[model samples]
Target: KKRGVQTGLIRTLESALVWVFEQFPGTEAALNDLLTQESGPESLLIGKGSEAEMARALG
Candidate 1:
């Protein structure tokens, strides 16, 4: 049960990251820059849990 939930969460995160990369080709560099600037890779789903928020985090 717990393992299944964890697996699902991993899949969801992977999908979200992939979507981000696909939507913005330059997101990789921006994400790298964010990592250098920020403390850690906190959750990207920060605002309204929308795609816009995800894109904001990536780009």
Candidate 2:
């Protein structure tokens, strides 16, 4: 169950990154490569609920 949650968070974050890259042209290659590299957010696994709460609060 924990693994599932982590995987879901990764997928969601990946989708968001793709959307961001799509919205801003010319950054696609850079973002795609960065997203897969060690320096990317995808390299980390954050708890889902906390991130959601943070997003809501920021909004």
Which residue ranges in model 1 land beyond 4 Å of their true spot? 1-5, 38-58
Best by lDDT: 1
Local error of candidate 1 at 38, Å?
6.7
Q: Any idea what lDDT model 2 has?
A: 0.58
Q: What digit string (tens of lDDT, one per residue) describes model 2 on residues 1-41?
A: 34446647888988997786677665666545645777556
Q: Considering only N, C-alpha and C atoms within 3 Å, which residue pairs clash in candidate 1?
A: none
Deviating ranges (above 4 Å) for candidate 2: 1-7, 32-59
lDDT of 2 at 36: 74
Top TM-score prediction, candidate number: 1
Candidate 1's residue-wise lDDT over 1-59, tens digit each? 24346547888998998997888799878888766765545544243457876567766
Report backbone clashes per prediction. 0, 0
lDDT agreement with native, every candidate: 0.70, 0.58
What's the CA RMSD of model 1 in angstroms? 4.5
